[model samples]
Target: MSQDLFKEINHAVLDLQGAQLQTYERPLKRLVSLLQHPDLETYNAELTEGLDLETFLEESARTGGSMVGSQRLLWPDSAEECLGLTFLLLQKMGEDPAYAATFAHDFYYSGSKIIAGIHSLTGQLIIPFIRDYKSYTQSKGSALVALQDVRSRKVFIVHGHDEGAREMVARFLEKIDFEPVILHEQANQGRTVIEKVEKHGDVGFAVVLLTPDDEGSVKGGNLQTRPRQNVLLELGYFIGRLSRDRVCTLKRGELEIPSDFAGVVWEDMDAAGGWKQSLARELNAAGYSIDWNVVMR
Candidate 1:
C-alpha cells in the first residue's frame, strides 16, 4: 500500500466509535501488521518524520531524552485517535529486536505526559506530547519550558454568555477557596476580547462555555459566525504553556459537540441546570482555583 493509503487507514482507525468496534478491529490489526513489514519500514516516521522508531527510541534510551512536544489538532478529528494509535505503535516497535531494548530503556528513563484540549462547543481537540528524562534533571528548549509551567493553581471560571453558568462557577470558586470572575457578566459592560484575555490570563482555571453564540461568523446567518472566536483564539495562544487538562469545556442547550473535540471528555449542561453543580464538583476535585501569588511563587 502507498504511504498515503497507510495514513488514510490510520486516520480511519482513529475515528472508530464504540458502535463500530467490531467493524474496525480487523482493519486496524491488518494496518498494524503492514506497518512493521521490512519493505515498508523505510517510510519516515509519521509523528517524528525522518527518524525511525529504532533510532529515536535508542536515542531516548541512551541520552535519557525525548522528542515529544505540544501539538494542536481538531478534536473528534483524527488527532484524538492518533494519540491512541501512538501507544499501539510504541508497543509494536518494542517487539522488534532493534527497538525493543531502547523502548525498555526509554520507558524506564523518560516519563510521558500526554496533554490534549477539547473544545466543548466546537469539539476541536489539540494534543501535545511531553517527556522527562530521569538522567537529565534540567530541561532545555521548548519542551523544558512546557514542563516548568506545569504548576498547581487555584480555581478559574471562564464564561461566554451563560449567566447561570457564571453564577454556578462563582459558587464553585467559593467552595474551592478562590474567587471566580465572570467574563460574560463583566464583558456585558463593554470589554473587548483582548481585554478579557488580558485580565483572565493569569487566573487559575478557565472554563469556557461552548455555546453556539460563542462562535464568530464571517457573514450573517451562518452557524459558524461570531461567537467563541475571540475566546478560542486566546485559548489557542496559551496552548504552548498549558496542558489540555487545565481547560474544561461545558456545552449548553441544543448545541452538539463539534467534530474537532469529539475525542475530549465533555459534559452536557442542557437540562435542569445540572451543569453548574456538576462542573463545580469536577473543578474542585481537579484542584482548580486562583492563586494571587502563582506568578510570584
Candidate 2:
C-alpha cells in the first residue's frame, strides 16, 4: 500500500513540473484534491486518538506552541505509526515536490521510524495537507498567490553608472514577470532620492549592482574599483530594513566591498555561470513563488 501511494505521489510531482498550467488545470487540481481523501482524516484520528487534547493544548502554549511537544503529547502507537508517516510525507511533498522522491524512497525502505524521528526532533512537519490544497487553488493564475501578496512581485533595482548592466537586469526581471522598480524611471517629483526610495517601500526584494564607477582606497592604501557611494548607501539601507536575505549584490567586475560585508554572498554578473538561476533562488527564498520552468524558458 505504501509503495502504491509513493508511486502515485511521484507521478503527480512529475506531472506538476511539466503540466502547462495556463492552458490546462485539471491534472493539478486532481493532484491537489487528493489531499482531501477521507483516508487522511482517518489517519489523522489514528495519530491523535487516546491523546490528551486539553493537556496538549496547554503545553503547546507553555512551549511556545512547539509542534514537537504537541506531537509527543499526541504520540501515535505502533499500529497508528504508518498513518502519521503518510501525513508527514504529504506535507513535505506540498512544500517542495523535488523532495518527493527522496521522501518516498526513505519511507519505502525504513517505514515509519524515519518520520517518527523527524516528528520528535523538528516541529516543521505540522502543516496539514489541506492547506496545500488551498494554495494550489489560489496559485492557478501565476503561482504568485502562493506568496500571498501582490506587492511581493516587485523587485527594486539599485545600480551605479552602468546603464548597460542595469538595463540587462531590468529586462531579465521583466521576462520573469517581476516588476523592476528602477529609481531613475520612477516619478521622483520634488522628493529627494532617499524619500523616493522610502516611498517605494512595498518592494519585496532588492538587487544592488556594484559596477566599477569609482576608484577608492581602504586605509589610504592602493586604489581599487568600487561602486558609487550612493549605491553602497542604498545597499546598506536595504540590508538593514529588508534583511540581508532579501537583498542581493551583483558585481560587474573586481569591486571592493566593505570588510564588514565579508560574509554576505554576492554574485558576479560576468563570471557567474547562471545569474538568472541565482536571482530566481534568492527571490524564491524571499517568499516569492515563481515557476522557474516557465520563467527560465
- Find the candidate with the highest lDDT and give its number: 2
lDDT (10s digit) by residue, model 1, range 207-282: 6665555443346755643335554564444332333444566766555344555555556765665665555544
- Model 2 weakest 10-residue run by lDDT: 119-128
Instruction: Give the TM-score (vs. native) of candidate 2.
Output: 0.53
TM-score of 1: 0.37
Q: Over the full model, what C-alpha lDDT does candidate 1 score relative to the true structure? A: 0.40
lDDT of 2: 0.57
User: How well is each residue in 1-297 modelled by candidate 2, as lDDT tens digits?
Assistant: 233543454344333322321311333344544554554454455454554544533453453333322222233344234234444544445555434434322322222323222221111222222233233333432212222232256889999999988998899888888999999888978999999989885676799998999998969699988889999889988887766656888888887888877877798787543777888766654445567895567
Task: Please give the CA lDDT of all the candidate structures.
Answer: 0.40, 0.57
TM-score: which candidate is best?
A: 2
